[model samples]
Target: MSRKLLIDIHTHLYLPRYAQLLRARSQIPRITTLNGEERLVILAGEAATGRPVGPSYWDRDAKLRFMDTHGIAISIVSPANPWLDFLPPAPALQTCEALNSDLEEYCATSPEVELGGRRRKRLYGMGYLPVVPGQEVGGVCAAVEALGKLPHIKGVILGTQGLGKGLDDPALLPMWESIAKAGLVVFLHPHYGMPPEVWGAQENGHVLPLALGFPFETTTAVARLILTGILDKLPALKLLLAHSGGALPVLSSRLASCIAHDPVAASRLAHDARYYLGRMWYDAVAYGPEELAFVVPTRGTDRLLCGTDHPFFPPLKGEEMWMSVTENLDAVENAPGWSEGEKEGVRGGNAVELFGL
Candidate 1:
């Protein structure tokens, strides 16, 4: 593949239907007009200081335009954070079905691009699930089966919280099995950060939650999944961790040591803790080349797919190109040990092979 065939695997959008669902809510995860501008209030204490949202959050045309500007040929889009987890089991399942249908339609009807002397869709998607607690595994499996039938929906975006418990919950084993059986990748993302008191009593904007909380949440969740031997049982499961495995690569050694010291924990896994990092996939969204380089040893070059968490970290100064996107692109380009072919793999080739794009 040419270097120009850049594929972004972590882009996001909220469908109009999902947006309307949020707008109808009277709680934290709702949209409301503040001082004549619409803001999305998803996190705790963000009701008054929610961030502004607009067409970029839902418009397909806007997404294509952004892709064109950034030289992205294809994007694997998913619904953004705080997904249907807060709703009741019935509403959550219903909402997820509707949103999944909308996402399929969104990708199926997108404009085509010329690639490899043929026309193909410029967009694909990762669907959502009603993985709430008390929701039947049968229902979730049925949803997974439905996603498998959609040509454009290649994977499912899941949060760290599984069935209202964390990923380590044995209750989610059937959920993992069904997803694996459908051959859909699980793009594990983080939404609930650490407890608020850790950041101190004073207001700190979103800096602490975004920078520290999100990644830590991912790290802990994934660690629990690994330590509890979920990956050991579900060997066929394909997990693509957001934010470059969220410090897992950096902390795997320490975790291994701790597990080694504890006989009960060490006996649970078939292999060492670090070995599972290679088994999982990661996106190059860590912003620094050094971070990407550090991750490659544990998560090999082929497992590292390029991504941009777009529509979240847009240019603050109204610049045309997003720094968040470029920073990740640059990281993959300049990652110390990567050769040209390896860089190409990280940029788009890996995603093409992983998602069968």
Candidate 2:
């Protein structure tokens, strides 16, 4: 029997140079040493209990080993959240250009993989952009143009916010047009969850913010884009939503109903809010088969791709395979009503076609 192709499209890694930049900062999203171990403190209230940072984040060898252990053949890595969102326009553009170059080199230099009958680079990348507030459209568009020239960059990862005002901001139209013209996918990820108070004063670690807040953040961003006609204006834009499209698949019907009741919103969209769901892609990182199965009906099997949010949700203890990886793998393999070929596509074939990998 032939080996099943497994490509992870949602992995994350910070290049060493980028890590050093974080280390130099003293605020949230900085990397600091706590009791002799480097810890990455990104989200709000994480400074006291930041996650450990090590080779798994930046070491090429460590990434390869993790991939091998999890049966992932190829990984499309991007910088984790808070990407260029903090920097001023000038510094943001400079850092975006340099980091994108490093990202291209990082993937371009990785060892090749033998799959089917061909040898291809084992790694690929999702580039970053200077999407910070006050960043001129020219700079953002320029980054998009430069990314088009990078052979290994298949897409660009983005946070929910766009130029400070959220994705619906009109200022991002030029950047959107440039990305679509360049034929690159947008991997929409959530960084800033809801306000800190929404989680209350309880110390629940990252459970509420990550599990609940992240999904809703993505849900709100995409909903605004749809209602505001971003999709209608740029039908060619290829967007891949992370975390199984957050809460989109489940809430799309609700969104459509709400739009139906609101005359203003009803006239705003070109189609039913749910219809746009078909126009976008989603990753199978829901951590459960049912949630994975739920998204397929919204867009069918073709739009679903497998992903592992590697190096973030690593095992709680030593050397064990990550549940985050295994759960997603099982979800794709066992999603109800899917044929063997469909499962294979979600496993890797879909990504191969989507990003031209």
Off by over 4 Å in 1: none
Mind giving the per-residue lDDT tens digits that candidate 2 earns over 183-211?
A: 99999999988998988887888999999
The residue-by-residue lDDT of candidate 1 on 1-357, one tens digit each, is 576789999999999999998899888899999899999998895867799999999999999999999999999999998888888889988999999999999999998987667787999999999988778778888899999999999999999877777888888888899999999999999998889899998988999998989999999999999988888888889999999888788888898889888999999988988888889999999999999877888768999998889899889687888988988888888889789999988888899899987
* lDDT accuracy of residue 249 in candidate 2: 94
Candidate 2 clashes between residue pairs 3 or more apart in a chain or in different chains: none
User: For model 1, what is the C-alpha lDDT against the true structure?
Assistant: 0.90
Q: How far is candidate 2 from the true structure (C-alpha RMSD, Å)?
A: 1.3
Candidate 1 colliding pairs: none
